[model samples]
Target: MIHEKFTKDSIISLSNLTVIKEIDDYTIGDEQKNIFFRVPREAVYVIEEAEGHNTIEEIQNSILQNKKIEIDVLDFMNTLNNLGVINNISLNEGHRNNFIKNLGKLLFNKTTVIFYIINILLTIILLISFPNKLTPNYQDTFVLSSIGLSLLLFFFVSWFLVFVHEGAHYLAVSATGKKMNFQLSIRWFWVVIEANMNTLWSISREKRYIPFLAGFFIDILIINVSFILILIINDIFVISLLKMVALIQFYKIIWQFIIFLRTDFYYVLLNYFGVSTLTKGSISYLLRKISSKYSLFFDQLSIREQIICKRYSWLYVISLFAICYLFLFFSIPTVFHTLKTTLNILSAFAYNTFEFWDSFIVIALIFFEFILWIIAAYKRFKRGD
Candidate 1:
């Protein structure tokens, strides 16, 4: 809630504000509310001067003297107050300092980089030296005699690794003195685990990269460790299971590179370009151009961003076509084959037999994944995302 009135004589103080400069405007706000606004650079300077030491009148006069612009200090303070930026609430640091002190050294140091490099080199050398043993095979996923049991085990292990991957991201953001939200979400037709750290916008671009790429780093580590274990172990079952895990991790890494899907790497690219809403802006611009029925979202963008979106809109259109191609050629056929195989097994095998259970479990898992996707989609729609 905001105070009802303010006088020019009143001293002004701002909440903990994050002001990041972009191509044309500055993104400024309090991260506690996860709310931000794009203000001009002059407004940012005014915000910086509102540190509770000066009266609104003095601050306005100072800005007039320094920047030769006469701003309504009272109106500006009222606007900031309405936006929850000029508040008396003290944010809880809550072990953030400790987290930065500890995890910062453990995860973001030179020693860790060297260790990661060594692991990568060792993994490469082992793969080259024993290509046959290191290469992933589909048969490795069916290590158990019962196909149903093998698939269930694989599914559980894959989900556990997903948890670890998201955890890495959570920890990285925590190290930067921020919190991240974890959710079960859907990406197109696939159910995915996600970590939402929108507050990262309040942080510097360089610090933001680690959190975005943390999952990829963890996946690489898992792959390397799995390969190392495969070389050290002679048991066929152990080797096969390790190979399956490594394969899944490798697939995840590749999936992140699918920029059209808005993967982690996509966020990295957005940060690198210092653009906040490139994907959404580009898609909306393309839509508005095709049909005026759409909202004037594209017209609302800054000139610099409008140009960027116009250039990227063509690529966005191509990616949409590519998605349609993949659905027609790959996704539909794969689902069709799985259902066909399951139906045949169900018809041929007795109800109590392992073959019947295998088919039943596969169908059940597919249904479960579909239900999850539905739930995620509903949540997204409700939020107007």
Candidate 2:
């Protein structure tokens, strides 16, 4: 009856996972290789209709007014969960405003040359004291144990780096006689330390670039130093930690391709495009313009997005779909793999005390992403035409 019920079962899961349907909401589209159930757009409408009082049969029968739901109804329900678009509870409006408000509050500091020097010394000492601290192969070692240690190392070190990076932002703002507030923000499970220095409007682009680039600078310096240590050190602990840090730096570069995420990379692209929050806002602005003379939907849209829909609807729509797919499969894995790898290292360090929690945190992060996605999409939909 319930969607979670279907996930708990076997046959229903394997048989009809994703329901592809026509844009018109009647014809059943092609089914891709179904790893999990993907709800149809039609089902989304039905679910909305059935939110509280409507029965499944009634909803299904309604959708089938002219055409039937060829896939299993329960399967469709489970698919909603898989796609992360549906849930038992009414979805909470995501923290879109919090994100914008966080701009000034989200600045972070970076590691200076001195920090790198100390890190190098520590790595050298560790390598010298124990040249052959063997860690278990992932295959031979228990999955839970390996995963657990990996998580612990990742959590601590990752947090440490974030703190240092964010701290640099805070200090920079402070030096200018401006104060900031900090928060742990998530952009789809990629942990970001955000510091708001909203008062930094008068700050020069050069000053702004320093705080933005500081984190990666520290990460790059640390990573290269790790590579130097790796040239001699035979220990898994030392090598893995360094590798993890380097990998994180590499992962952040995805921000370049995305043209969003409010990273330095994104800022570069936005400036080039002559837009703020360029990608998401573009399509909606276009849509509003195209539809204003034709569709009432455009009339009801938010003023900002209405402007976007008018200005760049066609381009915006294409980019929207393109970026969404890119973010989901590519960006998601890149971050998770880093998180997973980091966790594996930490688990090794901690002897895997909280394996369950490690898995939970990872999964929780994955779920949290959809909310951000919604906020972004909503903003795009509401951008000035």
In terms of lDDT, the best-performing candidate is: 1
Per-residue lDDT over 1-385 for candidate 2, one digit per residue giving the tens place of the 0 to 100 score: 2345443122222222223232222212112211222233755455444444545555556567746654355556555546544434443223334433354334332335356456546554654665454211222111234454554455566568767666666655555444456654545444455665443433333345554454544554555565566567787766666566644443443343443355555443332333333454554444445655434554555566455535544544444564665566455565666566656655666645565565555555445556655655554457421
| Worst window of 10 by summed lDDT in candidate 1 | 325-334
Task: State the lDDT at 249 in candidate 2.
Answer: 40
The lDDT for every candidate, in the order shown, is: 0.77, 0.47
What digit string (tens of lDDT, one per residue) describes model 1 on residues 127-207?
789889886544566667766677678789989999989888877888777776877677877788778878788877777
Per-candidate TM-score against the hidden true structure: 0.80, 0.41
Q: State the TM-score for model 1.
A: 0.80
Q: What lDDT score goes with residue 161 in model 2?
A: 71
RMSD of model 1, in Å? Answer: 4.1
For model 2, the stretches where C-alpha displacement exceeds 4 angstroms are 1-145, 175-177, 189-191, 268-281, 284-385
Candidate of highest TM-score: 1
Candidate 2, residue 100: lDDT: 32
